[model samples]
Target: MLTTVRLSIIVMVLSISGDLFSQIRNNYFSASHPYFNYMGRVDSSQREYVRFDWPGVRVRFRFTGKELKLYFKGGQRNYFDLIVDEKRMGVFYASGDTVVEIEGIKGKGPHSVQFIKRTEGEMGEARFYGAAFYPEGKLLPWIGNSTRRIEFIGNSITCGYGSEALGRDEKFDPRTENVLKSYASIVANAFQADYHVVAHSGLGVVRNYGDNQPVSVNLATMPQRYSRILDMDDSSTWDFSSWCPGAVVINLGTNDFSTKPHPDKAIFQRKYEELILKVRNVYGSVPVFCLVGPMIDEPCFSYVKEMVENFKLVYNDSNVYFIGIPTELLNDKDDLGADWHPSYIGHQKIANFILPVMSNILKWNY
Candidate 1:
């Protein structure tokens, strides 16, 4: 009798375990699921997973669940912000192949979840293998993309480098680089638009920040990098036909002028024009706003203004316009982030400065 009782208990336990395992399997959803909505430049070539490195890339989904788990594989350590039902829950880090869990859900009904990449592409590429939910849960249709689209091609400013840092003196750490807080993201959000950020810290149109090289030998400049889907991989050419923006914002020249021995002024102008031409080549007369900064003034400001004017005349494209953000835009004492980069507050100010120009040009309200 004792042996029989033990056998019955063993079988019951195994049966329950099998059911749980089967339930988990049933609840798993692939990253390529049609219900998943992705924003920014993402490579979804793989059926099982989606890869992205650009900061501000977002994946959103709605599902009926009380708990959620995300399966992600990171090329290196990367951080992402979790938003549940339009509220930020927290930041989560992923490395290697890992499962991130969000439990203690308050409701039994369907909930929305969004993951926004906080770090720039140079930090690492990440692959999201999709999400798993509670046994009874399943994915629902995601909110569709916005009709308005904007593309920002810039440097560290667009990347939101150090936006979350405690102070201006603080050094840059990938954990504090929240691209969602950058001016590019803020402007896009304000306009209720989808945005793609093609930016890298210290990169420029010709000479990178603190680099003395001439234009001929300069490597990995914005023009070259802008066409890439992945920041770190040069071979991953982005297909422009897949996505096009209603407007393009270019904020370069800060890094080029950050130090002495800047690239030749003529070369800088030529390269800058070339970039605008490249944008026109693919996008076809989209409004291109060439921005000068709150960072460095004078030469960069003047250079960009002249370049845009010449570009309009030469290309006979009146859609290209120049907008300058004065140096006084940021309060040096309170608005500087890590290593004197723009803090979240600073980025907000920048966005405000550009918003009106964009609104008037694009005829977009709000």
Candidate 2:
């Protein structure tokens, strides 16, 4: 009789446990759902998936658990970073179909997670399926995102190509690039602001990075695709009405200066001014700053200065400003990212110089 009673007790406990575990399985929310908050060029469609291809784009959501698993698919090999409860855990490389399981989280009641795509569109697209929580956990209510918004528009530097390398000569890999540490990201994070990075590698306003190449065609330039979705498929336009940024940072022209067969000064300046006008039209008097970078040479910096001055004249706009960061800071042996790009340290050097200027402009404390 005691043996039978013991068996019955075990069976009843398991039945109750099974019902509790089922709650976690039933609580998953798709990426297309509103529970997921996206930044940058992530597109949600009726097809039940969210596709993101740009570097520095991010997806964030909340869950109640000590373990979380990310379900995702990518058009090609891709790398993404995870930040749980405001701390960066690590990067995940997803090549085939799989679940990125993050276990043993340090929290108790609830946790916040942000999946950040580190590679640019050159690698291919990444589609987020959804996320799963641990046993008996569920989703949290959505309060709005953190702070003011800033949009960064530029090229390889902004994409943070080769920024994760510790050594100077290490070859570039998609897995070694991290946009989360780029200068754009660093400054935005300092301000506790949401940022959008619209960038592509080896692309510029007038031409791509190549030696003695032909002049770029109409649609080949980065500016042509700036208004598009995921920086691809021109037919799918990015509605500017979707989100408004308090400031827009322009970081182009490095590729144009570094690449051979560059355009004449008059032509480059005209194109730059035209792009600025188009930006103003879309953003409507939003503060625009030309972030002359810690990459290109003095001549390029001169060009950026002239372009910003010229545009401000056209609109008589005081909101337009020039932020010049000398490229010489990266000349030190320890400063190079990889293939001479800015590493996390190099990005920090630039951020330290520029962030203070931005804080002054916005009248911010930090």
Candidate 3:
């Protein structure tokens, strides 16, 4: 009888241990898992952690579970948008290393999650460690990336600075800056394209916003930063071949022409042309759209249009085109966000204006 009792106890313990092991194995997934689909310029060198700093960077995956938790290590305060099963739950902020838990998920079967960065690179970088699911879950194959891709290069406007501010008089706050609400994002979502934003607030093609000296070479200009994977890290070069865009949009000149001592037209045009050439060198005849303002006008507008026309004539390139967003497109009273930047409504208008043009140019069905 003593021997039989001992045998039964051992069997119970073994069964419990086996169940625990299986639960752990099925519930946890590393960030490097093949099923996690990462978009934008992400550094995946580390097996356990994937890092990205660009605005609009996104990670998507699917799993089967009732509850999900995501782990992240942020170098600085950054905001993100969390979407589960195509519905946006809300915006959340992460700083330092932390775990975000979403409890009481609606369905019991399979569900999808999209985690997107809503701020720009200046907000700092973040590392995604992995995810954990409760009550028996397993990672599913990723939904997959869109075949359509676009790259937008610009300054504050493209970065969606002050996009979510309460009003034009409101001060610039990081919390209010939502790139997901920007025109670039709106346009991308409209066409169902995976897009990249190589944008920095206050940056320009030749001179940055409010710089006193004109024609001074800004080492951190958009052209120089274009090749970097991380906006702040100049040493880290992005592999252009890894992801190429079907269309490229350059929405600069707002910062270059915003302040006094404007850059010489010749110099400005030269730099703009160089930037265009750089795009050509990288992608080989991808449709390039030279965009000018909803904020800037006059010389900046004329300069861009002239430069694009000249570039086409000189290079014999028909793929390059010019599009302008006039100041009249937005209403000053109702359409401004923080610090007089375009609000979500303003961005929507901008997207609507450009959508048809883009569709006509790229032959993409709306």
Would you list the C-alpha lDDT of every candidate in the order shown? 0.84, 0.75, 0.84
Better of 1 and 2 by TM-score: 1
Error of 3 at 236 (Å): 0.5
lDDT of 3: 0.84
Better lDDT candidate (1, 2): 1
For residues 1-366, could you state the per-residue lDDT of candidate 2 as single tens digits?
Answer: 011112111110011222332354465666777778888877787555688788888888778977776777654757887777777766666554445666667655578888888888878788887776776667775555866888998887888888888867887888778888788899888988888898888888787787465357744688888888877666677888888888888888887878677777787778877877877888898888887777787677888798888777877888888888787777657778677888888888888888888888887655
Listed per candidate, the RMSD to the true structure in angstroms reads 7.6, 7.9, 9.0
Residue 347, model 3: lDDT of 93
Error in Å for residue 259 of model 1:
0.8
How does model 1 fare in lDDT? Answer: 0.84
Higher-lDDT candidate among 2 and 3? 3
Clashing pairs in 1: none
Off by over 4 Å in 2: 1-25, 106-108
The 10-residue segment with the lowest total lDDT in model 3: 7-16
Any runs in candidate 3 off by more than 4 Å, and if so which? 1-26, 216-219
